[model samples]
Target: MSTPLSATFRAILMRDIRLAWSQGGTGTMALSFFMIAVTLFAFGVGPEPQVLARIAAGVIWVVALLACLLSLDRLYQADYEDGSLDDLALSPLGLTGVAAAKILAHWLATVVPLILIAPLLGMFMNLAPEGYGILLLSLLVGTPALSLIGSIGAALTVSVRRGGVLMALLVLPLYIPTLIFGVGAVDAAMGMVGSSANLALLGAVTLVALAIGPFASAAALRLALE
Candidate 1:
């Protein structure tokens, strides 16, 4: 009997999540980088509450963005290197389903931890009381876009050795709009402006990323395979 498509998709998703949690995995590295980078910013900018609070949203968003990048190179590389990508491409779910599964797995294993711990980081940076909820909200809404958009860059560079730098080069520019709205939402909540519009825009960006990421990544994977 053939496996169902949904079952295959779940299997792929679980497999990636398990892989990401293993020794020296992407999730561990990304989370560690996020904490260290944000902590370092607090130290470098001095302990002034006003100073840390002022830059906290931007610093957190920037570090989060970089942390997301840390795992992009490995996004498709392991499967490609091991030739399982070919089997996946031939599966009932096909490359698009594979890409989508990996994207969701990336978000769950990588960015979700970042979102959960962001409040603690927010306190560390002395983020204003009002900004904390919006900060978490922004990360929750905005980071799916990061994972989705990042999959494109990862797929594009999957066949290249040492493609982490190249993937970042390609993806970081694309990340700016999401970063802007994410920080803007938090900043607005801090009384710089109204946060509603920024949050809407951030959500919109995630929706757009959802619309395109899977197909774009799948196309890139197809080319890499060929």
Candidate 2:
């Protein structure tokens, strides 16, 4: 029997995830890039623990953002090139579902490891014990917005050859709000007053991104396919 809608959605999600895993070192590459970026930040800033602690939240978020950019060009470009996107669009799940599934898969493949590793790296930057939980929570809340907004850039530029630069220019500005609230939440957890407010605002940004991303990406894909 053919799969149900929910099953189809799960299949799409898993398929991309599996492909991402099998593709030589994609997940590891993003993680390595993230770690290296943070390490370099440490080197450049010198070894003052207090300074590191004060900047840990921003540094992690900034490096995470740049690492995300590394993978965006390939998000839909491979499928677009290989005609898989065309096939996906023809599936009963439709293009919007396809976009949503792809974005989720990207998040799982690229951002999840960052979330897992951020705490350890934060410790290197002198993140307080109390800050670890909030760092993870903030990233959990914020990283989805990165993938969702990124997919819009990926979709919008799916047709342009070597469009990574253009996509970055278009998408990085949109990322500022997420980055701000992400750092804010970590700061709050470390004793900044009003952090709960930051967390709420971060979650709100993610919700808005999720609400609009799939539809925007799907529409852009249709335009490119035409």
Candidate 3:
């Protein structure tokens, strides 16, 4: 009897999640990078509360974006190298589904931890009290787009040697809108200018990424396999 497609998807998702949480995995590295980068920024800018408060949202958002980028290089590299990607492509879930699973797993394993920690970093940066909720909300809504949009770059460079830099070059330009609205949302909250519109726009960006990323990533994966 053939395995169910839903089961295959679940198995793939669970497998990736477990791999991500293993020692020396992307989750650990990304989280550590996020913490260290934020701490370094706080130190470099000195201890002026006003200065830290003024730059808090942008700094945290930029660091979170970089953290997401740090993990994208490995998104497809291991499977491609081990021949698991070919088997995945042949499965009932297909390449697009595979890409989707990886995207979700990446978001859950990597970005979620960053989102959880952002408030603590915000406190270190002297982020205003009002901005904390908006910070969490923005990251929750915005970071999925990072994973979704990043998967395309990951797929495009999966077969390249040391493609992490190339993937950054490809995706960094694409990340600006997300970074913009993300910071805008938090800034609006801090300024009391109403963050609802910014959050809505951020959600729109994620929606667009959701609509396009998996298909684009699957196409790239198919090309890489050929």
Candidate 4:
């Protein structure tokens, strides 16, 4: 019998989280990398608070996007290496369901932490309090789309040698729209330019990704598996 949707989702999420935890440094490494990247920008641009505050939205979004990218290679590579991916393929749950759960797990593991850590990073960048809230909110809506779209790349390159570099190349172009709207929302909110339009665009992109990402990822996984 097929697994119930709720159970399958929960199981998949748990499995991914457990795996991530076992990796023993994924979160710490990604977080440290994010902090370092932000710090580099701070130093590189000089310590002008006005300039930092003005650029804070872009800095946070860019760092978070890069942080997420740092972890995407492991999204499916670990499972594929260990033979669990084969079992998942043979399981009763549809690949789309698996893909959705994996994307959710990726968001939980990567993006959620980025949101929680962002305010601290924002302080370093001299982000306004109001802009911090906008940054968090935009990331909440935007990063999942990153994970979803990234899953397709992960699946496509899972079996290839040197897949990580290829995955970055494939995924980065696709990430531009999300990055634009995400930072735009923050900028709009901070500038009193009205963030609703940017927020709406981000939501539309996310909704489209939610509907299509799973099927696309599943297809890629099937092709890789074959």
Candidate 5:
């Protein structure tokens, strides 16, 4: 019997999750890196609580972006190597669905862990309590867009020899706007001046990515595979 599109998507998502889980260190590695990065930032910037708190939102957002980049190489490398990419291309579900499923899976594996660990990392950075809720909320909405946008980079570089570094180079520039808005939202929650426009712009970016990223990524993947 043929599989339904929804079933195919679920299967792909579940497979990616199981692979990520069994690998056992992706989440831990990201969380540890996040904590370490924040801690180092605190030391490098001085231990003043006020100073740390002042830069907390930017610090957290920067760490999250780095963490996301750390795992992006895995987004398509394993599949491409094991010929799963080829099979996905041949599947009836189409490349766009495959790209979306992969992006969702990457978000679940990478972004969600960052969100869950953000509060603990925030404490290290002396982030204000009132800002934590908004920081988490903004990241929850914004990180999926990061994964979606990064998917295009992953797809474009999947066949490249130095794909991981290349993927980072390609995606980091794209991430600046999302990072700006994400941190802006948290800063706004902290009563900083001129943050509402940034938060609204972040939401707008998420909506635009949701509308367009999958198709763009799918096209990239198809071209790479061809």
Candidate 6:
């Protein structure tokens, strides 16, 4: 019997999750990178608590944006090499759904951990207590946009050799809005102006990425496969 589209989506999502876990856990690696990057920033900027506190939110957002880039190379390249990409593209879920599922899985694997651990890392950077909740909230709302937009880069570079760097080049420019509103939301929450507006814009950006990313990624995948 044929499975429903919802079931297909779930299955694909679960399968990718399992695959992602099997390969030494992208979540752990991404989290490690997040931690190390933040620590390095702390070291570089010195032990001045005031300074660290001031830049904490923006630093986290920026590091996370870069950390997610580390994993985009394998987002589709593995499946493409092993012939699974062709089959998934041909499946009932279609390329768009497949891309969405993969993006969701990648978000789960990479960004969610970063979001979860942000608080602990925030402490290291002397992130203000008031900023903790907003930091988590901002990352939760904004990181999806990173994954969604990065999917397009991943798809575009799937067929290219050593595409991780190229993918970073492609996606970093696109990440500015997410980074800005993310930090702005935290800053606003810390008694800066325009808290609601910053968060609303962050949500708007994520919504736009959600609406456009899958289709654009699917198109890129198709062209890569051609």
Q: How many steric overlaps are in each model, in order?
A: 0, 0, 0, 0, 0, 0
User: Against the correct fold, how does model 2 do in TM-score?
Assistant: 0.96
- Report the lDDT tens digits of candidate 1 across residue range 123-218: 999988889888999999999999999999999999988888899999999999999999999888888678999999999999999999999999
lDDT of 4 at 54: 93
The per-residue C-alpha lDDT of model 4 at residue 220 equals 91
Cα miss at 131, model 3 (Å)? 0.5
lDDT of 4: 0.87
Question: If scored against the real structure, what TM-score would every candidate get?
Answer: 0.98, 0.96, 0.98, 0.96, 0.94, 0.97
**How well is each residue in 124-224 modelled by candidate 5, as lDDT tens digits?**
88888898888888898888888888888888898898888888899999899999889888887788575567778988998898888899989888888
Candidate 4 to truth, TM: 0.96
lDDT, candidate 4, 84-173, per-residue tens: 888888766778888888888888876788789999999999999889778989999998888888888899999998898999999999
TM-score of 1: 0.98
Instruction: Give candidate 2's root-mean-square deviation (CA, Å).
Output: 1.2
Q: What are the lDDT scores of the predictions, listed in order?
A: 0.94, 0.90, 0.94, 0.87, 0.85, 0.90
Ranking by TM-score: 3, 1, 6, 2, 4, 5
Candidate 4 segments whose C-alpha is farther than 4 A from its true place: 1-3
Question: Candidate 3: where is the Cα deviation over 4 Å?
Answer: none
lDDT of 6 by residue, 33-150 (tens): 8999999999999999999999999999999988888866688998999999999998898999999999999998778878888899999999988899889989999999999999
In the order shown, what is each candidate's alpha-carbon RMSD?
Answer: 0.9, 1.2, 0.7, 1.3, 1.6, 1.1
Output the better candidate (1/3) by TM-score: 3
- Model 1: CA > 4 A from native: none
- Model 1's lDDT to the true fold? 0.94
Candidate 2 clashing pairs?
none
lDDT tens per residue, model 2, 153-215? 999999999999999999999999999999989887787575789999999999999999999
